[model samples]
Target: MSLTRLLPILGWARRYDRDDLRPDLAAGLTIGAMLVPQGMAYALLAGLPPEVGLYASIVPVLVYALFGTSRQLAVGPVAIVSLLTASALSPLFEQGSAGYISAAALLALMVGAVHLVLGFGRLGFVVNFLSHSVLVGFTAAAAIIIGFSQVKHLFGITTERKDHFYETVEEVVRQIDGTNGTTLVLGVASIALLVLMKKFVPRVPGALVLVIASILAVELFDLTDRGVKTVGEIPSSLPAFGLPDFDTGTMGSLIGTAFVITLVGFMESIAVAKVYARRHRYDVDANQELIGLGASNVASGLFGGYPVTGGFSRTAVNDTAGARTPLASIVTAILILLTVLFLTPLFSSLPNAALGAIIIVAVINLIDIGEMRHIAHVKRSDLIGLSVAFVATLVLGIELGILVAVVASMLVVFARMSKPHSAVLGQIPGTTSYRNVERFPEASVTDGVRVVRIDAALSFVNAQHVKKLLLGEADAISGGDVTALVVDCSGINDIDATGVEALSEILVELDERQVDIHLCDVKGPVRDVLRRSGLWDRLDGRIHATAAMAVDAVTHPGTLPESLRSLGIDERHDERPADTVDTEVSHA
Candidate 1:
């Protein structure tokens, strides 16, 4: 690999245009202002101190600017990754304890290590196993869980964290009467302010506005005395570089969580990156992205921060604010570094209720009811997978929930492949083209000939299924007197040993029944497999270039159609040896 490929900034930095500076600066400032509240809020969501979020926003953003492929993806503490961090670590230690914080940082390191290994190994395609349905369902469920997990902060009530979402809901309901009037009012007002600003003046950073107003309200009115919780005394210095304690047992326990975070974080980051890359008409290398994100997470871990990834909302804001390159991310990181160094005191009086409100508002859109409805209309099987994932995530904890979601997605895939679509084909009038007879009722079939197509690669899992479907189609023809069967191999791109064996069996059965079997449009790979299996020699004179040619051979006997003659085939072609004659026919 080249130096420029290893460090993406090396490629883009040389071409850095001065004209982009103004817009990059503006976008950086905009996101930096927005990240102030969001980073802190997401940190609290992850069960970490607010300063850790600031720490993450700084180092991760800068690291991604150096290694990341996207020009505008602003990397930082995202809500989903934060929630996963908490889910992974909360069982091992008390939330926000020194040990818990260290474990969180270690998790970031482990996640980054996994990403780097996958990137180097060129295994980035492994994430394809996480199908869209699974992501949608898991994201919606996690959003709900994250939203409700903030109720205690929002209402200023004391409640123990529960393992399951329903337990949390029940605890919230049981403690509803203990809600602090002051805190509830502030949180509700904060939510209202965020909503209004988003609707009316989306260009402004609403979270920042809410954070400032809430801090002023708490400080001016002495709200803490009335039981309004505030983000007390954040350290007013930049995070010092350090390595997390790597206890073997803790590392072993965290490996699974780190893997989950690695996949989920990269999926979220790449999804947004691809969207922006397409809009800008640029390319994003997936493996290179893994390396970038891996480096960013490693930086976060070393700098006293938790795991981070590309957040969709922030990336959208970055793009809309006119970020043309990763230079904008570096600028944002600098702004965050300044906040850590000089502006930490301003947030000391910030209300926890305001942060809770911000988190709730941010995650509510992730429910994605519109996407679920669209999935139901477009592919109900996928809806089943989505529903399974949603219910599993809610019933099981987030860690096991994701495992179940992946399994459900795989099962859905296997189910589809095992029973893939197959159709009886018929020739359209006045054309050599063939189509599904069921779809095109006007298309007519030739007497004593059966044409069938299976729209999936043949494998052990579906070989028997295809064999039965093909034979059934041959038998179901009117009068059941089929003299010839034409297998359309256009859709069969590949075949395994079991598939070749199944075809051999079908050929034998057809021969016993006195029906000639012909294969047409056989893909080169499938043909090679058949030849190696010694089936190609048995299929010698039966294979043709197209279904139309096969049908004409059986129907017209010694005469060649004008269309076939136009392709330069002579009348005496069939008189040649089977190998020579087959070689003479066009495979196009």
Candidate 2:
């Protein structure tokens, strides 16, 4: 492994030129503007002091810039991870207490450790198990919950937060009559202003605009005296480095939460990195990205911050702001550091409702309704998986919802694979090409040859189904047992011992019925397995390279030419009379 691979900053820094710095500076300032309001809002969302979010936005951005792979990715606190942080720690400690803050920092450390280990171990591919359907469902549900969880802040009313989504919403609604008039107005107006500005003047940072405007309004008009809650005091100093709690009792309690945070945070970061990398035509190393994110989280935790990830919204802002490199992130970190040092007092008047509005607007984008509808239109099973994830997250907590989503996705996959698609293939008329007989009605089938195509990898999970489907097709024939059964293994990418056993049983059954079972288009690995299992010997010269040759050899015996036969094509025409094909079956 090269040093550049481990420290991605070295790769770009060696080629850094004056031309890149200007854009990086401009983009950095813009991202820093967005991050200030968002960081504080996300910290509140995580049930922590607002400055912790600022603390997170600073060190993580710098760490990721030094070690991360994607040039354009902006790493910091993200909504989903913040919600997860709150969810994970709320039950274990009192919200915003010293114990809660320590737990959050510890969670970040554990999450960082998990990422570092996975990256160093080169186990990045493990994330592939988190199917898109599961993510889609889980994100949409989490977004809704996060949005509703802020409703109390939006209305300026106190309500007990419930674990269940509907219960939380119900409690919020039950307190509707207690809504503070000034807070509601501020929240609603901030949301409207954000929407309008994004529509009409998108180049401007709307959250910054809202935050600044809200702060000015509150301070100028004495809104705090009007029953409007402000953010109060924020420590006007850069984060101080500190070690996280490492006590076995404290750390053990947070291990499970940390694991979930690791998965969610890395998933979010790598996804953003890949998206921007594709646009810039550069490839991102997932494992390297894991190490980068792990380092960022560790840095954040050590510097009095919670777990953070690459946020999609801020990264988009960075890209649109014309950022050319990760230098933009470094500059952004500096600007955030400045904000903590000098600008903290100005934001003391920033209303909680306004920050709540910012969070609401940001998280609203996470709900991918269009994706749900598309999934529903395409695959019912995927839609079910998506639905299961959404509902589970809404009813159960984040951890259980994710658990349900993963299980539901796996179950859906296994259900489809358990009875894998098998088709009866026939040669397209006047062509060497063969297709599903039912799909291509014009195709022709040989009288004595039954060509069955198994459309999935043959594993223990589906071996029995394939065997039964093949036997059932043979039995369905009206005439005496087919003289030859040609099993097309074109789509069978792999075969295990159970699959070989299933084939052995099929061969015996066909032989008892006076049918010669021949295999065609058997993939190399599968053939190797069959040979090792001794099924190849039982095949007795019945395995052909192609379905056409197998059929030709079965129907016309020696008429298949050597070259065409070697390529799995039947050189000879079908000489059997049409009426002799009493059972020319073809179905998808």
Candidate 3:
């Protein structure tokens, strides 16, 4: 592999246009403004000090810009990953405590290591096992959890953390009477301002506006004296480079969480990357994306921050603000670095409620009711997977919930594959085309011949099932009159050893009933498998190019179809040798 391929910046940096600087700078500054508030808010959500979010925005953003494929993807502390970090570390140590902070950094390192391993191994396709339905469900549930988790800050009332969503709801309800009126007003006003700005002035960074306004309001009105909580005394220094503590016991405890974060975070990053890549008509190598994200997370861990990923909202903003290259992200990192250096003290009076409000608004759209309805209408089985994921995540906590959803999705896939769609086909009127007889009632079927098609790869899991279905289709025809079974191999793109064995058994059973078996439309790969297994020689002179040719031969013996005549077949049985026949059939 070339060095440029591994280090993507090497390829793009050399091609950097002078004209791209303006847009890249504009987009970078816009996202930087947005990330200032979002990064800190997400950090607080992850049970860390707000500045850690700013720290994450700096190093991780710079790293991903250098290594990532997407030009517009803005990598930082995202809402879902933050919630996941909190879910993982909250159980082991108190929120914001040094132990919890150290563990969070360790989790980022572990997640980065996993991504690098998967990327280098070219195993990025493993994320596809997480079906879209499962993601929708899991995301929606996690959004709810994240939104509700911020309620204490919104209301300025402390509540004990609970394991389940309902328990959290119960605690919030019991403490409803203790709500701080001043904080509630500020949070509500911040949410309103954000919503209005998003609706009317979308180009403006509403989160930044809210942060500035809230801080100014608190500083001027002395809101802390009114029992309003504030993000007091942010450190005015850049993040120092340091490795997370390497405790084996802590690593063991965090391994599961780290793995989950790696999968979930990479999935989120790649999904958005692919979207923007398609929009701009470029390719995104999935394995390379893993490398980029892995490196970013590693940087985040080494620089006093938590795990980060490409966020949809921030990426959308980046693209809209005219980000033409990863240079925009680098600009974003520079802005965050400047803020950590000089502007940290200015945010000392920023109310916690405003940050909570920003978080709630950010996650509001994640609970997608419309997507649920769409899933229900498109595929009820997928809806079941979605519902299972949503409920499980809400009930069983984030880790177990996603685990159950993945298992359920895999089971659904296996069940469908085991009983794949098989149909008895008949010829359409005045045409050579064959279709399912059940769907095309007007189609004509030849007597003493059954044409069956199985629409799945024939493997050990479904080999027996295909055999049983083909046999059942033959038996469905009146009496023992079936003399020929034409198996359509067009849909059967692949067949394993077990499938060949199953076919052999079927051939023996049919021969006993005095029925001849014919294979039609055999794909090249399946034919090769048959040849290697010696099944091709066993079934010599029985394979044809099309279903119609096979039907004609069975119904009118000692006569060859005009199409077959060109292929050098005899008028009697097709006596062509196996090797030669495949060559002719492939061309036909």
Clashes of each: 0, 0, 0
Off by over 4 Å in 3: 479-482, 559-588
Instruction: Name the weakest run of 10 consecutive residues (lDDT summed) in model 1.
Output: 564-573
What are the per-residue Cα lDDT tens digits for candidate 3 across 327-383? 999999999999999999999999999999999999998888998899889998898
lDDT of each: 0.89, 0.86, 0.89
How high is each candidate's TM-score? Answer: 0.95, 0.93, 0.94
Write candidate 1's Cα lDDT for 4-102 as tens digits: 999989989999999999999999999999998999999999999999999999988999999999998989999889999998898899999999999
RMSD of candidate 3 to the true fold? 3.4
lDDT of 2 by residue, 39-152 (tens): 999999999999999999999899999889888888889888999888878877888898889888888888899999999999998777677778888999999888888888
How does model 3 fare in lDDT? Answer: 0.89
lDDT of 2 at 67: 87
Please estimate how well model 2 matches the true structure, expressed as its whole-model Cα lDDT. Answer: 0.86
Which model, 1 or 2, shows the larger TM-score? 1
